[model samples]
Target: MLLQSHLRSVNPDATTIENAAFVAYRKDATNPDHFIPVVPSESIAEAPYILHLLPALPPAWPNGHIEGLRARGGCEVDVTWRNGALASANVRAPHGGSLRLYADGSLSKTIRLGAGETIAWPLP
Candidate 1:
């Protein structure tokens, strides 16, 4: 399964994502030691899965930036960014499923996806 790299951008361009399968990042974008890529264990069968990579571990910080991520499925999500910082996301899944949203500071949320439904998720 491959995910589009442009999903990482606050303002995605027309460039298409190709030949990539993993979305990678660091808990702290500035900390090279914490870099990790998010790889889904199973092929996405329901919602189009996309990730919003926050700028910092707490994510509530006033500053941060975007990181690259990759995944599969055919759901389009609109990510909301505030002043170059991560804020929230609107997600939709075509077949319905579940996702565990995670943050660097042990913060996580389990979202239930309904078929052809859109869900909005806010970040801390």
Candidate 2:
């Protein structure tokens, strides 16, 4: 897809995802270094299926950013940044998802994500 590389923004004019057969992420959620597979989805049965480029082992971490992840439910999630440590970083809701985060063994805050949306939160 033609795209513009920038932060906190997707050039809607240039950015677009199409024909994604299914979403896949690491098995050991939170651990970027894990296996990922794109299986068919029962949720989106009528949706078209198109397998994009197969994913490969992540080479590095995004500031402890779980290197790899799969789109569970329907919405995709991400932790823009964390203060120290991350306790939870996964999205689990079909239409909209909510996830809790913790740092230094302390509950950070609750995160809510909408479908096809990216949320940036601060972790204590």
Candidate 3:
């Protein structure tokens, strides 16, 4: 993925930071994946980061399950599983967050913290 940013224009007062573009691409020919091109009418697209959390057991879960968490900016994700497994991660900007898979698929709870605030989501 390639990202580019530039200053489009500056007013007399120089109070506004106008027009930014984010270009995503895959250079490898083996993995040819293309994103929906953004036109002048619609310049900006908001792509949210998603993490999949799944059980680590054999046979029952192969690719694991999708975790319904949309992360933005800098945040931390804390995961707790039923099999006494605990994991925590801090996410940085410029690159999307990381996806942490717990051994025990049965997650008890997940906590997301950002900017001195925390949101807790319980799983079934």
Candidate 4:
């Protein structure tokens, strides 16, 4: 329910809007039922969004408990729209990275590279 709460906090309109979809997935194969939301594509389209990572605890197995283990990390997505297009960036913490987009109404191609990265593609 943390994800639901988080989404509510980030986008209040989401609660009132219909046709919004939320999905979850488990990162570890051993715990298939342990699902969590990974990417919120639709919600991300909403400007000025926030993403939170919840705390983690090691799973109990064979009647044993373990401590000192913590969840990987978390991120907060901040989006802004300008001139009839959506522009946003993701700020990742504990490990830092960012994703930005420059979109137009029709079709557009943009390549982003960071620190010794190379990308090749075709434009249509």
Specify the highest-lDDT model's number: 1
lDDT of 2 at 48: 22
Which window of ten consecutive residues has the lowest lDDT sum in model 1?
10-19
The digit string of per-residue lDDT tens for model 2 on 59-99 reads 34323444234443344434323333332443334466543
- Residue 78, candidate 4: C-alpha displacement in angstroms: 1.5
Off by over 4 Å in 2: 1-66, 71-95
Q: How far off is residue 25 in model 3, in Å?
A: 11
Q: In what order do the candidates fall by lDDT, top score first?
A: 1, 2, 3, 4
* Candidate 3 residue lDDT tens string, 1-124: 0011121221222222221122333355555564454333232223222323322334433322223233334434444333323233223332332221122233222223334554433332
Instruction: Give the Cα lDDT of each candidate.
Output: 0.42, 0.34, 0.29, 0.28
lDDT of 1: 0.42
Best by TM-score: 1
| Best of the two (1, 2) by lDDT | 1
TM-score of 3: 0.27
Cα lDDT of model 1 by residue, 1-124, tens digit: 1122223221122122221213454365778667666654454233223243442445354543332232234455555466544466555667765543322222234456689877655533
lDDT of 4 by residue, 8-90 (tens): 22333343212222334445567776665576566554323222212121233112222222222233323333332333322
**Residue 12 lDDT (model 3):** 22
